[model samples]
Target: MAELVFDYLIIGGGIAGTTAAETIRQKDQNGSVALICGEPHFLYSRVLLPEFIRKEIELDKVMLRTAGDYKKNGIDIFLNESVCDFNSQTMTLKTISGKEFRAKKILIASGGRPKLWNFETLLPGNIFRLQTLDDALKIKEFLSSRPSGTALVVGGGFMALEFIAILAKYGWKIKLLCAEKYFWPDFLDETGFGILKDLWQKNGIETIFGREIKNSAELDADFVGVGIGLDRNLDFLPHAAIKPPSGGLEVNEHLETGTPNVWAAGDVASYKDRFSGRRRSGGNWSGAFMQGRTAGLNMAGGKESFKNIPVYAISHLGVNISFVGDVGPFDEKFGVKTEEIRFDKEKKEHIKIFMKDNRVIGAVLMNGQRFLGKINQAIMNGWADSKITLD
Candidate 1:
């Protein structure tokens, strides 16, 4: 019996894995590329899960690429299969179903899994985490059965805000619980937080801060949407030199791990930012796409460095929020600088720029989509005095 082998083996079927596979095929047309995804579907936009859940878009609209696309590109895709173990020395991986695969090079784009709370009591059927298409489908099914009901949303990130907006749109009474005193404490300043809080309250949604649920019995709600955060999916490669940190698997500018011929991208790979010189992990779709392309190029003997500033934008409840660069409430020891430029407080139009050593590193653009391109360019060009105006 012989084991199956590929020129490149990719784990995870999200944007990162698919983009990398496409890149590899473009460069080496005849190279055998295999992508193993634990999920059942092909590449789809995880960011659009809220829309899918809201029934605003069909399931097909969320898909980024179809099986036909993969087949046309000559990339083999393994769906609904989980990789159980990896042997870096032998350059081989084994799945739970006792299937073994060997590859010359491997890229880990396994991304992140939803972080759920450990409750002593069994959770009701209405609880959901919107990470995958399956999760979105389940949520849609749950909501279909119960058209309108109270929902307790946990966490204070983009996912939480999106869920709250979706449920609220369906005429569901929503209560948002945040562990911090403000929304997205990492990115939002006091003024920005105040604006968001006002927006939520104006929608007739109760927004609570600095609250921790010790037990599931404390809140009475029809459903609970947990958007707390994500944990890296790197337990399969436990013996690998690249240790998994709380953030994700650390990689270099080339998106390569410490081990040779191995790389990582997307949510799982915490790589150094070429512009900001900071180690970051698990960014938005654009960043992940770029990282995957870079990883594929580097793995295929091309010297490509990932230098894009991570950006994420969301429109929820009549508010458009965009975060670019490093926009961090980072440790005081880092001396990260942040400046807020408010154009219209009433309209919640503003831009917050984060800097380190007089260089523009990151920004938060509230209702400021026009500035995204220019600001991203400024950061890449290392412009210290980049000026943004809302006219």
Candidate 2:
């Protein structure tokens, strides 16, 4: 119904989008920037959703940016507005509400959403999906009614563990079903998983590994929490090619989408990485934040390339875990090899280094954080240059 023209436009209101908008304003103060957020929220930290659920932090702490921040920066924010289609030729993007946005340059940082069991069919009863602040609030509300209940969380990813921890905090019994034999099957080795399993048991978490949820009705539980994975929002833009494996918009080193005058950041971008030797998506918080800044710089007429060695770390059930570089299983086509640093019996820790054709590809650390700096160096530069002596 209304047409909004801006010097630059961004799709998404998460940390990445917010960071980009702020960076753009800092770089080019006079650029009329407009950001479209699908959610009503201005900007909130997705990383702290579990903390909010556990009541470890106040809701105010979870909110990263206020309306005043945007107002002060002169960033025009269109909340609760989702872009439906983007036209590269006309440099116009149409929203679901028929609002059109035409900009000189655009950045798609739409991020990701929780994957429902069935997209076409309606979500079954008592099934929980945690991806937004609203979702966490609903979960908190649900827990308030039932003082004691059984929560069956399905998945081994970050959110699955978060669900178990939160439910346990609320004095609710938990049943965990991981899709793989071990938590982080691709990333962790025997000793690494053993450490996590021990932590879960210590916290009274009953885990059932290798059980993918096929039916919700068959399971007996008060509620089911699904944390399988997140899905990219690319259905609207068919013009941009979706890269396989990562399922994100393919971007060059500078976060430039092959499409003209368009760029991407956050989880939506499958950017070519110098360290990882592949086009990797910004799956974690640090990746999203850095990519947004990099993308914003390039969009605002500054030249910058993203140099990153992927690192994902989490603390749940009183144990710290980290996955770095290409932690997942390598493709069958590549001549892959693995060299393990083995577990430290005294330290109760494990370290496994993945190599492909004699190059340091990935490393998984479980309580063995002393080598973190060296592992990072190895992944970025080379193993020999890392100055880490492995026995």
Candidate 3:
């Protein structure tokens, strides 16, 4: 007869929402907290989806926490429920099923959904996109049902590379279609691009550049894996809450949104970074995890600011590719200077450092994950050493 009320209501059950719920429960034992997740599965690592596809790890192993664990933490877990709308003024939200919930403090960690390329012709069920556990499971099923054949991976970003690597590992003929002139055109410089292209070609991955997959029938492949990009999941938010110039909800250093008692974290929140002095959206796991922790702490009345260097890494073809901090293709207004570093022949390292105002702001490391700690420290300490030689 009455709507349930919680002290802290977190929407979405990915890393950000779950982490925020855990943080809040730890700090305030008596505070009522609940997390509403649209998916049926419990908290699981999306990063390990590749391993799951390879069957190296079971489905249970992918789960980060069990239902019992959430109960032990005193967190109310709502699964298979989607929040359709929210009223910021009353701090209340309604699910698509008509269930209503009210909260004193709200954290939107809904994250992003895969951006699908629109085609005039309808797509077949064989095509796949990797963003959720269900998507991974469906892809596994599809692969198992059919014989190994060419997998046309469309896109040149991190997600595309990941799918390409996984398909290749499974002995599928992989053809990568790059919409841009080079791989990761927004982040990778010429040297890094060259290195990646050579590696991909060496591995027998036929990479075609300056092409877009507008029609499903363009390539003759057994299946297609689309990884164009992700669009932030923010359709439910009110018009006033959406940020300007960009669509994501704008949050300050503390992850607080313009709406009072409301906060945002993860991919959906375009936050102001204290370290970079820029407002940007972070789709990486590290940034989302830290943002959730910071938002939870701040929601619990703790004064905390998020100031960590964002890092994203993927291992492909025996090479470790990592991007740290503000490595995106930023405009000249940011006064960013990029320096490309190449190591010896044996090591085959390609490192690109982005510097702004004589301070290290971002870096792209290939086969050099070991240097991340030192580089992060140097960036935080304001080290301006432009020349980085790894012995």
Candidate 4:
């Protein structure tokens, strides 16, 4: 029944929310700012969690900020607190612990969570998902305590690849089981997938396709690593019908939520792309961090639009896999066309371009090339992809 008031409020404690808080302080120092964090710990790097789990980096390296830092900046951070109810009409948020936070403006940076199978009820300790720092710590601990054994990784994205790498290093038998036969068929072309598949085989990692894990025991894995997908954490959104086409909070170029005194950023924002005019959500850490800055600027009485070419890159299985822009579901309905090319024959480098109306919209590259900058610029301006040359 405690009531707190602030000039501005941020819901997530990830990079987005933390960056937004810092940006808000820079813009309006006197504005009372309150950040409600669902996690008990302060901000940390989600991108580094994989490296930490792999033991390539120390746990202390993952910590990005301390409570002292927030206090120094005059930001009130409520860790281990989450909103249970939201009243958009009054701009009021009720926490799970019955604390009320009233703010003149609010930001939604709640991000997303790993999608897990309900099998946790049957085998709790064996099922794992790597989405947070805690998840990485627990996974590392689990591996340290148990002997190397068969591991089943169910996913087709970056997280699944990370799990494979970590398990393989631990000298465990690893099998990648995903429902997609061509993994990222939307963005990655046949050659890109072929390259990855070949690399997987070279590393002695088995690949299983067109399958779903209904029974954990049936897979014969000592444990399961689930990275099937990321679900937007909209639990605080209530039953309100404000969801956008991307399944996150709908936002304009300025990151405004289209609701009075509200804005959204990071993984939880389904913002209209400044280039394509299509709505999409960005999952990469850099994208979230920049979006938070843009949202913070606008929320502090300045008008600014978020415009960044979405880029995601990861080194896995002895190759560099990079994706830019809105890859697949290019919506043939929108007259989208795709082309794949092997840019470097000797190095086995490949690129796939997805376009509509001859404008570059998205692309994927394996063993990526230097021309990535041109691709980004072309996608940003909706420029004709014809001028983008590998040479």
The whole-model lDDT of each prediction reads 0.84, 0.82, 0.84, 0.85
13: Cα error in model 1, Å:
1.3
Residues 200-260, candidate 1, lDDT per residue (tens digit)?
8788899889988877686678888888888777778774544534257788888988888
Write one digit per residue (lDDT tens) for candidate 4, span 26-116: 9998999989999999999988998888889997899999989999999999998978888889999998888998999999898888764
- How many clashes show up per model? 1, 0, 0, 0
RMSD of 2: 2.2
User: How does candidate 4 score on lDDT?
Assistant: 0.85
* Tens digit per residue, CA lDDT, model 2, 206-283: 888876656546467887888888889877888437878878888888899888889999989987666547667767
Residue-level lDDT tens digits of model 3 in 30-75: 9999999989988999999988987888998898999999999999
Q: Estimate each model's TM-score.
A: 0.95, 0.94, 0.95, 0.96
Query: What is the C-alpha RMSD, rounded to one decimal, of candidate 1?
Result: 1.8
**Model 3 error, position 224 (Å):** 0.2
Candidate 4 versus truth, CA RMSD in Å, comes to 1.5
Worst 10 residues of 1 by lDDT: 239-248
Candidate 4's C-alpha runs over 4 A off are 343-346
Model 1 has an lDDT value of 0.84
